[model samples]
Target: MKLSRDIMRFFIIPVVLLVGIIVTAAFTVFYTTTARTSSGKIISSNWPKEFTHDFSEYINIMNGTPTISDTGKNLLVKNDLWIQILDATGKEVCNYDKPSTVSDTYQPYELLNLYQYGVGQYSVFVSSVNAGDTAYSYLIGFPLSISKVVTYVDTDRYNSGKTLIIMIIILTILLILALTVFYNVVISKSYERIRESLGSIASRTYKPVAGHRFLREIYEGLDTLNHDIALADRQREKDTKAREEWLANITHDLKTPLAPIRGYAELLSETNTDIPFERSRKYGAIILKNTLYAEQLVNDLKLTYQLQSNMLPLKKETLNVTRFVKEVVIDILNAPDLEGRNVSFISNSEAATYFFDPLLFRRAVTNIVVNALAHNDTSTEVSISLDADSGVKLTIADNGNGMTPQELDDLFTRYFRGTSTEIKAEGSGLGMAIAKQIVEAHDGVICAESMQGVGTTITIVLP
Candidate 1:
C-alpha cells in the first residue's frame, strides 16, 4: 500500500527544511573560507592567519636571509601586531613598533613559555631560525580577543552583500521547485485519479481504483455506490417486465368473464327469439353471476394496490386468535366450491387474544385457504392449525399437487401463478400477494415450504 499524500508531506517537508538549513550553512562556510592565493602567499580575512604569517616573515630576518620588506613591517604595525627579532645570544636585534610591555632581552626558553601560555594581554607566537653557525628567534604578539575574526570576514568578502543575495535567490528557487514537484506527484496525481474514476462511473463502466490509504477508502465507497446503482437498474428492469406481464394477465382474466356476460346478455336481448320464462330467468342469473365475478376481480385489484401503497384502512380489534382461525377455516370449508373438499382446523390453545384488524386478517386467511383448495385436486386435504410458541402462529398445510422450487419462490409475487397443473383459470394471481401484504401490515412474517409431489406448508407468524 502506498502512503497518504498528507503523511508524505509531513515527512518530506521537514526533510526539505533540514536540507535547506544544511545547504545554507554549507554555502556560508564555503564563501567565508574563500581565499586569494597570490605571490606564493595566502591572504584571507582571518585574523589568526594574519598573525601567523607575520611571525613567519620574522624567521627570514633572524636567519640573516632578510625576506621581509618595509611595507610588510608597516602592515603588521598598522594592525597593532608587534614584531621582534632576537640574535643567538638572546639580544633584541630588530623591533617593529613593539609595545612597552615587550622584553628587550629574552631567553629562548622564556620566549617559548610566553608563546605556549600566551600569558599577557596579547597572544604570542615564537619561531627559531639557523644561519650557518648562528641561530635566531622571532617573537610576534597581537590582542588576545577573538571577536576580531568575525569583524575581519565582514570587512572582506561579505561586505559587498552580492554573494549573500544570490545565495538566497538560488535557495528560494530550489525550495519552491521541490515543493511543486512534491505537490504534483503526491497530491495532483491523486486528484486526477479521482476524476478519472468519476468519469468511468458516469459512463457506467467503472473499474476499481488502486490508490493509497485515504484514496483507497474513497475507491471502496465508489465501488459500493456503483454496486447499488447496478442493483437498482436490475430491479427497475424486473419491475418493468412484471408490470407488462400483469397487464396482459389482467386483460385476459377480465375478457374471460366479460365475453360470457356479453354473450348471455345478447342472447336475452334478442327479441326475435321466443325464449321461455325459465330460460330467460336462467340467462338473467348467468349475467348477474358473471357480473359479480368481474366486480370481485376489480375489487381484488383495487385492494391489492391499496394494501401495497399502505393506503388500506384497517378496523383493528382485539379478538381470540384461536376462534378467529377456526371460524375462517369453517367459512372456507362451507363454500360451494369446497363442498366435497377435506378441510380441518386444529389449535393447541383454546383461546389466545390479540389486537388485529379482523376484516383484513379474515381476508388474508381466506386467500391462503382458498389458494390451497383451488390449486389442488378434489381429493387434496388441507389442515389449518393455530399455536402460540414465540408468537401467535398459524400453519396451513396441504397435500396437494405441490409446486416446483422456482414456483414456490415466486408464489407470493404479484400475478405469479404456480406451474402446478391444478392451477385455476379463474384466479387473478393476486391472492397470495395480497395475503402477504396484509400479514406484513400487521407486523408479521409469512413463508412457505413446499416439495414437488409432496405438499406445501405456509406458516404465518404474528406479533
Candidate 2:
C-alpha cells in the first residue's frame, strides 16, 4: 500500500483543521462565558479571590501608626472594593469608601455572617496586620455576582483525597490521547489503501475498495471511472480490429478483379495469333465487367468517407413517398440477373409528401433493398410497405434464411459479410454503415429485426 504526499496531506489537512476548530471553540467558550473586564484587564473565574486579597501587602501598620498605602487605596476605588479597619472590640477605626449599609460596629454573630456572605450583595475577604504587638483586622468587600460559595474542609481529609483526584485526572487525559492516536492510525491506513487503488487506474488494474463506510463516496466514484474506461477501451479495440479486416478485404477485392482484366487484355493483345471474333468479344465483356466491379468498390469507399466526414451536401425537397418507393424497388428489381425474384409493394395511401435529399436517399434505399435480396434466394418472397399514418414509415421484409442474433446486432456496423451468406456479389463492407448514416443525416431512424430461419425486417421511420 502506497501513501503518497498528496493522499497523506488530503487526510491530514482536514483532521488538523477539525482539531484546530475544536480547540479554538473551547477557548472561546471559556473566555466569553466566564471572563470579566477589570481595570482594562480581563479577569477569569478567580477574579473575586484575587481582587480581595491583592490589597493586603500595602496594609501593614508601622510603629503604632495605622496605615493603608496610596497604591492599595487606588486598587480598592478602581475595583469598587471597600475596606474597613477594626480594633479588638469590633469597632471601626478607619475606613475608605465604606458602604452606608455597613454599621460602625459589628457583633460576634454579625461578624460570622459578614465573613461568610458579606454586606448586602458584596462578597468580603479578611486580612490581619500588626504594629508593636497591637493586632488590627481589615475587611475588604467586592460587589460582583449573586452567589458566595466557600468550601470548608479539614486538613487531613483534603490532603488524603487530593492524590486520588490527581491520579484520576491524569488517567483520563492519557486515555483520551491514546484513543486519538488509534483513530488517526486507522484513518491513515484506509487512505493508504485508497491511494494504492487510485494508482492502479493508470495500469488498468483495479482493486475494489470495500467495507470502508467512511470512504463510500470515493470508492463509488472510482468504480464508475473504472467501468467507463473499460467499456471505452473495449469499443476502441473492436473498431480497430474491424478496420484492419476491412483494409485486408479491400486489397483482396481490388486485386481479384484486376487479375482477370489484365489476363484477358493480354490475351487479346497477342500479335502472332489470329483470335476468333466472337471469343475476342467475350473476353472484352469480361474485362469490362471486372473493371466496373472495381469502379463500384472505389465509389463505395469514396461515398463512405464523404458521409463520415459530414462533407456531403444535402439538397432536400418534397417528394411523393408512395411513388418514390415504388419506382425505387422496381428499378432495383429490373436488373437482368434479378428476373426470377418474387416481390410485392404495399402502401396504405396513394400519395404523401416528405422532404429529403433524393440523391442520397436513393442510395440509402437501394442499399437496403439490395441487401435483403442479395442475402436471400429468388424463391424467398420479399415485400415493400409504406404508410402515411402519423408520419412516414417504410418497411422492407423478406422470408429467407435470415440472420442470427449476433448478425442482427452488427448489421449496421462495418462487417463485410456474414459466414452464413451465399455471395453473388461483394461490396466495400460499408454498405449498411453508409445507409444508416444517410438516414441519420436526414434526421430519420433506421433499425432492423431478424429471427433465425424465420425472416428479417428493416424499418425506416421519418419525422
**Maximum-lDDT candidate:** 2
Each prediction's total of clashing residue pairs, residues at least 3 apart in sequence or on different chains, is 0, 0
Model 1: per-residue Cα lDDT over 1-463, one tens digit each: 4756655665577668767976999978865764333233433446554566545554454436434567667767666667777787788887777788778897768876677666466767666656777776777775553222323455666667778889997998788777757754665567667767788888888888764675677778888988888889877887778768878888887888889899988998889999999998998898888788888879889999999898978889988888888888878878887887898888888767888999999999999998888888888899888886557889999998888987887889887766577445556778899999999999999999999898899999988
For residue 448, give model 2's deviation from the true position in Å. Answer: 2.0
Best candidate, TM-score: 2
Off by over 4 Å in 2: 1-3, 26-68, 73-234, 260-291
The alpha-carbon deviation from the true structure for residue 424 of candidate 1, after best TM-score superposition, in angstroms, is 5.2
Poorest lDDT segment (10 consecutive residues) of candidate 1: 144-153
Question: Against the hidden reference, what TM-scores do the models get?
Answer: 0.59, 0.65
TM-score of 2: 0.65
What ranges in model 1 sit over 4 Å off? 1-203, 210-214, 422-425
What's the lDDT for all of these models?
A: 0.77, 0.81
lDDT for position 1 in model 1: 49
